[model samples]
Target: MSALPYPPPPELGWYDEDATVMPQQTAETQPAANAQPVASAGTTTAANPPTTAEIAQTTAQPTTASQDDDDIDWEGTVLSTAFTASAPKQEYELYNEQTGQRIIVDTGVLLGRKPSQDLPQGVKAVKLDDPTRTISRNHAAISFDKDGLLWIEDYDSLNGTYIIRDNTETKVEHERMRLQAPCTIRIGDQFFTFEQR
Candidate 1:
């Protein structure tokens, strides 16, 4: 037969002098109060506890930023195949095949540019001219996925893609960027940077 679980410390006589005591502990630990005998394990009843589903739900919740960053090794390549005139956004996805966290990097949110040019160069062309744009939501981006691949997608703007692999700058004329591990992709004038996720 399975052994009985250990009783919680609260069920015992242990107590902090400064704090109030529970009714169960008072009888066993406080003789001055004229307490009665403590109930045995079979005689005592456990109050409502967390349901199995509730416990599973809490544990299944998405990992926090710190936890996710710490848990995954995160290394892979980036591939982009998205661009349009009105919303010229590209998707930067990684394929690590290890942790299996699909990290997505989009351009529309990363770099802010006009809907005309595919790869608009210069700081001003990327909407960085307006100070508010930076604070707004038009900044360039570089992110990794669960698989550990890096991504650099355009943010549906005039400016195109930029790459800084091994400290060298290169333009991505194609809509997609097939990059290996530990590569950085910059989009628009802001030149967002991202590592393998």
Candidate 2:
């Protein structure tokens, strides 16, 4: 889990010493006790209330701002050891056999020589170190579906993409295939291993 960047503390003597500061702001923001609340369909209130039809009409109004559950800040008790506490999110990494480099996979990634422009947001585009020109501009994509599963698909590359499991090479020709950890992924000629931590 990434921690959001918070604003730095104010510098020394930054606050105005002469300016009047209010201790509370509730008085300005609070609604008047006698003010009647505007209602939908008609002038509703505590006394008259609203009919079932009126309630339905108000509830059917279109929502402009929809919030995703992941964007919401959640507070809870977390039991974590020293090692796990530092990295709160479940992480997956790709170990390149040729380059001997480990790259962290967040959401999903696109491994290619030069990444394509037509990529969805939150998906990383990686420039592979392919000296043989075996990898395509957008060779293969590690896709993340809504069901929280990882998948690999070939983007009609000249060579091909494959996933090896139990020494059996399964070609990802056109259709996407589910990718499990501790398996070798073959993008063109280079090989990479997918592992979870």
Residue-level lDDT of model 1, residues 14-76, one tens digit each, is: 443324554565555657655455665434323545678867877898977754654553433
Q: For candidate 2, lDDT tens digit of each residue in 1-197?
A: 99999999886445644234554549898779998777665567787978899889988976533223323433344545553433334578888877787778866788888987666777788888886779898899886665557888899999999999899999998689988898988888888888987
Candidate 1: 10-residue stretch with minimal lDDT: 122-131
Global Cα RMSD, each model: 20.8, 17.2
What local lDDT does model 2 show for residue 26? 91
What is candidate 1's CA lDDT for residue 10? 67
Q: Each prediction's Cα lDDT score?
A: 0.45, 0.78
lDDT of 2 at 182: 85
- Which predicted model would earn the best TM-score? 2
